[model samples]
Target: MNRSSARRPWHQHFETVGSITAIVVGVAALFVSFDQSRVMREEIRASIWPALQVDGFASLENGTLAIGLSVQNAGVGPALVERVTIRHDDSPVEDLDALRALMPPGADLSRTSLTGRVVAAGASVRPFELRYPAEESDDAIDVLNRLLSRWSAEVCYCSTLGQCWVASDDPGAPTMVDSCEGQPGGDF
Candidate 1:
C-alpha cells in the first residue's frame, strides 16, 4: 500500500530466496561427500585385490621326469588359501596318500599343504609333485595325460581385504564368493 510497506515485503522475499539457496547448497554438499566416500571404498578394494590360478607343469630334472600341480598368486596382493578341493572323476580325493594311490607304482610323490597357507603376490606353491626315472618317461607321460583328463583342482582363497574367490582349472574360474566356509573336500 505505502512505499515503506512494499519495500519491507520485497526484503522478506529476498530473505526467503537466500534461505532456499542455502538449503540447496547444503544438500549438494552432502551428496558430494557420499559419492567421494563410495569412490574411496572402491579404490581401497582394488588396491588389495588377489587372484589365484592353478597350473600344471611337466619337466625333466636330474634325469627324472617331474609332473606337478601348483597354485600361483598373480594379483597385486597376497592370497590366503582357505581350502583346496582336488577331485578325480568328480569325486573328492581324500589326502596326499589317496592321491598317490592313483599314480603308477614307482612314481615318487610329494605335496605341500595348501590350506591356511598364504601365497604372496607373484609367488607359487606346488601342491602335488611326482617324479620318476627318465627311462620310464613314456609311461609317466601316459599317466600324466590320464591324470590330467580325470583330475581337477579348485582353490578357495581370500585377499587381505577379506574378499574371497574360487580358482580352479575349469574355465571361467576365479569367481567371487561370499566366503570360503563350507567348501567341499577334505583339508589338503
Candidate 2:
C-alpha cells in the first residue's frame, strides 16, 4: 500500500484505543459510585437505630429525696414512642393520677411520669416522682420499695425508619417486632 493508505491502519488503531479507554473509565466511575452508595446506606442505618431502657431511682431533686422512674435512650438515634403502659398490682394503670391518689396524704407526687414519650439519643426522661423532705427519707424509701414491687412499665418505641421495639421493666429481654399494631405489652 501507498503512504496515505498505510496511515489508515494507524488511525483505526488509535480510534479503537480511544474507545477502549472510554469504556474502562465508565466502568471505574460505576464502581466508585456503587461503593459510595453502599457507604451512605450503612451510615443511615447507624444513625437511625435506637436503644431505650427503663428503670427507677431515688434521686435528689430540689433538695428532697424523690422516688422516680427513668427512661433513657442509649442508642444512636431518637426513639419514637408509640405507647407507655404502666402496670400496677397486675393491672394496667393508664392514669398516673389514680396511682398518685392511692398514696398517703403527706406524700408528694406530681404524676409527672414520662408516658407516651420520645427520647433522643443519650437522653433521659424521668417524670414519675414522689418527693419527700430530707427528714422524711423513710417515706421516700417506702414509696420506692412499694413501687418496685407493685409497678411494671412497658414502652413500645420506634425508629424514624419505621422499625419497632418493645421494652419492658418486666422480666426477659426486650423484643423487636415488625410493628406495634398487634404487639401490645402487658395490660395495655
Top lDDT prediction, candidate number: 1
lDDT of 1 by residue, 1-188 (tens): 77875777544777788998999999999999999999999998887788888966677767888887888888888999988988889999888888888767788887788899999989989987889788744555675677689888899999888999999987665899999998786657
> Which residue pairs in model 1 clash with each other?
none
Per candidate, the number of residue pairs that clash is 0, 2
| Structural similarity to truth (TM-score) of each candidate | 0.85, 0.64
Candidate 2 lDDT, tens digit per residue, 1-188? 57875677654777788998999999999999999999998899778788878776776556677776778887889888877777778777656666666555556776543545668899988757777675634565665677789877778888888888888775555679887776444322
| Position 181, candidate 2: lDDT | 70
Question: Where is the poorest 10-residue window by lDDT in model 2?
Answer: 179-188
